[model samples]
Target: MSASLAPECNEVKERYDSCFLKWYSEKFLRGTARSDECDPLFKQYEQCLSKALKAKGIDNMLKEAREDNRENDAEHMRPKR
Candidate 1:
C-alpha cells in the first residue's frame, strides 16, 4: 500500500490510503460499487509516485521487470507443437 519509493510522498500516500479505506468500507463492502470517491486522491498519489520513481531511477527498472513478466507469461502460454 505504500508508494513513492518509500519515505518520499508518505503524507500524500497516507491521505490516499485513508480515502481508500473509507471508500472500501463505505462503498465496496457496502455493495455500492462507487469508484469515483477516491480517484482524485489516487491521481495525486500516482503523480507524486511517478515523479519519485523517475527521480529514483526506478521507472525504467520497473518497465524492464514488466517486460520480463510479459515474456515469461508468453512463454508459459506457448502452444504445443
Candidate 2:
C-alpha cells in the first residue's frame, strides 16, 4: 500500500539524483558550448532534472540546478591547486 509506494518513490528519486550528477559532471566539462555532440547528454540531464523536480515538488529546481552548475563551472575554471 502506502509503504510500498514510498520505497518505489524513493528509488525514483535516487535514480534521478544519480542521473543529474552524471549529467552535471559531463555538462561541466562541456562548458558553454551547444554542439550537437553534447545534445544527447544535455537532453538526458534535462530529463533527470525534470523527474527530480516532479518528485521533489519543486517547480523552480531546474533553475537552481542551472545556477549550481554555473557556480561549479566557475570554480573549476579557476587556477588549479
Candidate 3:
C-alpha cells in the first residue's frame, strides 16, 4: 500500500504538516520581521519534517499540504472550533 494509505504514515504526515504551518506562521507568515530568534525553532521544524518525510517518502506532498494549511491559516487565524 502507498504510504498515504497507511494509517500510521498518514498520521505522521498530518503531524509534519501541522508542525510546518505552526512554524511558518510564528516565524514568517505573521507580519513580524525575520530575526535570529526563530532560527532554533525553524531548525527543529526542519529536522522533524525531514524525519517524517524520510519515513514515508512523501516530502513533496507534505510541503504542498503545508502551503495549503498556511493559506487557510492566513484566511482564518483560529482553527474551526
User: Sorted on TM-score, highest at the top, how do the candidates line up?
Assistant: 1, 3, 2
Whole-model lDDT per candidate: 0.83, 0.58, 0.63
Q: Pairs clashing in candidate 2?
A: none
lDDT of 3 by residue, 1-81 (tens): 123444444545555566556666786677664554545555655565577676777877878899879967787896777
lDDT measured at residue 62 in model 2 versus the true structure, 0 to 100: 61
Candidate 2 off by > 4 Å? 1-34, 60-81
Give the 10-residue window scoring lowest on summed lDDT in candidate 2.
1-10
Winner by TM-score: 1
Model with the higher TM-score, candidate 1 or 2: 1
- TM-score for each predicted model, relative to the true structure: 0.68, 0.31, 0.32
TM-score of candidate 3 to 2 decimals? 0.32
- Number of the top candidate by lDDT? 1
Q: Report the C-alpha displacement of residue 44, candidate 1, in angstroms.
A: 1.1
lDDT of 3: 0.63
Whole-model lDDT, model 1 = 0.83
TM-score of 2: 0.31
Q: On residues 1-81, what C-alpha lDDT tens digit does candidate 1 reach at each position?
A: 654455777888999998889888888988997557889988988888898788889999999899879978888798878
How many angstroms is residue 20 displaced in model 1 relative to the true structure, after the best TM-score fit?
A: 0.2
